[model samples]
Target: MRIGETAAAAGMTTKTLRFYEDRGLLPATDRAPNGYRDYPHETVSRLEFIRRGRTAGLTLAQIGEILAVRDIGHAPCIHVKDLLAKQLHDLDARIAELTALRATVAEFHEAAAAGDPAACDPERICSYL
Candidate 1:
């Protein structure tokens, strides 16, 4: 199949397919005489795998490592688990920070609703209610 057809089948853009190829995630199997990329039917599965990996918060380099393991006929479950663990830790930290920020914003909103003109402190740049 051509790049366009393969990309559509994988629910990705042709540009994304080309980017994956450049990133060494999905190298083309062959090229036509006109220089168009020729991909095998399985390319869709590969692209889907890449898409899922990215959605799971894996970077291209991380996905490339998984692909390398697959290419070498090894299971990538361990590596993927480790990566997910790290991402979860990072996400937890971000969630805590966002929760604190939300509390601060809610407090400010309450003060503004109370008609406290001092709420709009010029030093704070947003102190006025």
Candidate 2:
């Protein structure tokens, strides 16, 4: 398949495919006499794996590491597991931080609702903000 066909199969734009290639996340493709990219049938599956990794919040470098390991005939199972655990831990921490922020905002909302707007300070930004 050509770049267009491969991109369509991967559910992404041609530019995205090019970006992945430029980023070295994708391997170089074969070229036709007309100077067009040619992809194998397995490229679509590889694209799907890339898409899944991105959706799972893995960085390009991390995905590249995983792919590099696989390219070397290694399963990368343990490495992937450790990376996932770290990602999950970071996500949990961010969620907790956001939850606390939400609680603070709720308190501010309540206080603002009960306070007198006429008493607002003229030399400073809104305290609620």
Candidate 3:
């Protein structure tokens, strides 16, 4: 398949395919004698896997590591599981931090809502703050 056809089949733009190639996320493809890229049909499947990995919040480097493991004829399932576990742990921590931040902001909002504009200190911007 050609680059455009492969990108369309993979539901991505041609530029994204080129970017993936440049980033080493994709294997090097053969070129036609006229210099256009000639991607294999299996490239579409690989692109889909890359898309799924990105949607799961995996970094390109992490995705690359998984691909590297597979390229070396090994099953990357264990590595993928470990990576997902770490991602989940990190996501939980971020959610906790965001929850605390939301509560603090809500309190500040309540204070602001109850504040009198006339009572705001001139030295500072607002008394509520």
Among all candidates shown, the one with the greatest lDDT: 3
Query: What's the CA RMSD of model 2 in angstroms?
Result: 6.2
List model 1 lDDT by residue over 30-111, tens digit each. 9999999999998889888988878866689877866776676745587766865766676688679889999999999997
* Residues 60-85 of candidate 3: C-alpha lDDT, one tens digit per residue: 98788777766777555776668657
- Clashing pairs in model 3, backbone N/Cα/C closer than 3 A: none
List lDDT for all candidates, in order.
Answer: 0.81, 0.85, 0.86
lDDT of 2 by residue, 9-57 (tens): 9999899999999998889989999999999999899899999988867
> Any idea what lDDT model 3 has?
0.86
Clashing pairs in 1: 119-127, 119-128, 120-127, 120-128, 121-127
Worst 10 residues of 3 by lDDT: 120-129
For candidate 3, the per-residue lDDT at 30 reads 99
RMSD of each: 6.6, 6.2, 6.7
Instruction: Give the Å error, residue 23, model 2.
Output: 0.9
Candidate 1 local lDDT, residue 91: 62
